[model samples]
Target: MKKFPMTVGGEKALREELDDLKTVQRPTVIASIAEAREHGDLKENAEYHAAREQQGFIEGRIQELEGKLGSAQVIDVTQIPHTGKVIFGTTVDLINMDTEDTVCYQIVGDDEANIKGGKISISSPIARALIGKEEGDVAVVQTPGGGVEYEIDQVRHI
Candidate 1:
């Protein structure tokens, strides 16, 4: 099985979701199903059907979370030795060569990637180009639009 990389915070969030699913959602759905079944008339039981669908969804999420946790390779960014390179879990400040716009992004696991949160997936084109690049280095990223250049201003491991 291929292991998925995850930051400590990402892993914690996933674990918390799993715990909530197992402890709360699973039991709540089970109880709902039981209550629905008590209404009788299995042929025309909308509540029972809805509860069953919800149960399926909850169980599927639980399994997915468990699998992710099992195959996760959690990395603690703070514990890793930093040499100013833009590796995973490290935030990098970049200046767009064309637009001259400065932006900061943290390369993180796929699950933790949120552009609005200043996080990008490690597999993203920009992050791939930024990897192994130190401060003051130029990274050329190949995007669908065209090739874009960015100058690395700073690398922070947080």
Candidate 2:
């Protein structure tokens, strides 16, 4: 099976969600189904139908989390050795050549990517272009808005 690459934090979050689903949601939904069964007629019982639908959702989520956790390959960014080059889990500071604006982004696995948090997926166009590039190198990314060049100002494996 293919391994799912993820940061330590990302793995922890998935674990927590799985725990909550198993320990809390599963039991709660079971109780709800049981309670709905007490009201008699199975065909016309809205409460029973609703509870079953909710149970389905809960079970599907539980399975998805389990499968993902089973194949997760957690990586620690702080432990990786840095050679002044951009790599997976490295945070790079870049300066836009045209706008002269600075942006810092942490190259992370898909599961750990949150653009709002300044973490970008390694497979993204910009990240792909930045990989293997050293500080002072200009990386060009072809975005939907067109090509943009960014000069690497600093690279930190954090």
TM-score for each predicted model, relative to the true structure? 0.96, 0.91
Model 2 TM-score relative to the real fold: 0.91
Q: Residue 127 deviation, candidate 2, in Å?
A: 1.0
For model 1, how does the per-residue alpha-carbon lDDT over 82-135 read when each residue is reduced to its tens digit?
899888899999999999999999998998899999999999999999999999
Task: Give the best candidate by TM-score.
Answer: 1
| Clash tally, candidates in order | 0, 0
Candidate 1, residue 140: Cα displacement in angstroms equals 0.5
For model 2 the local lDDT of residue 101 reads 99
> After TM-score superposition, what is the CA distance of residue 96 in candidate 2 from its true location, in Å?
1.1
- Lowest lDDT block of 10, candidate 1: 80-89
- Model 2, stretches more than 4 Å misplaced? none
User: How close to the true structure is residue 17 of candidate 1, measured as C-alpha lDDT?
Assistant: 94
- Give stretches of model 1 more than 4 Å off: none
The 0-to-1 C-alpha lDDT of every candidate, in the order given, reads 0.93, 0.91
Tell me how far the alpha carbon of residue 2 in candidate 1 is from the true structure, in angstroms, after superposition: 2.0
For model 2, how does the per-residue alpha-carbon lDDT over 116-157 read when each residue is reduced to its tens digit? 999999899999999999999999999999999999999996
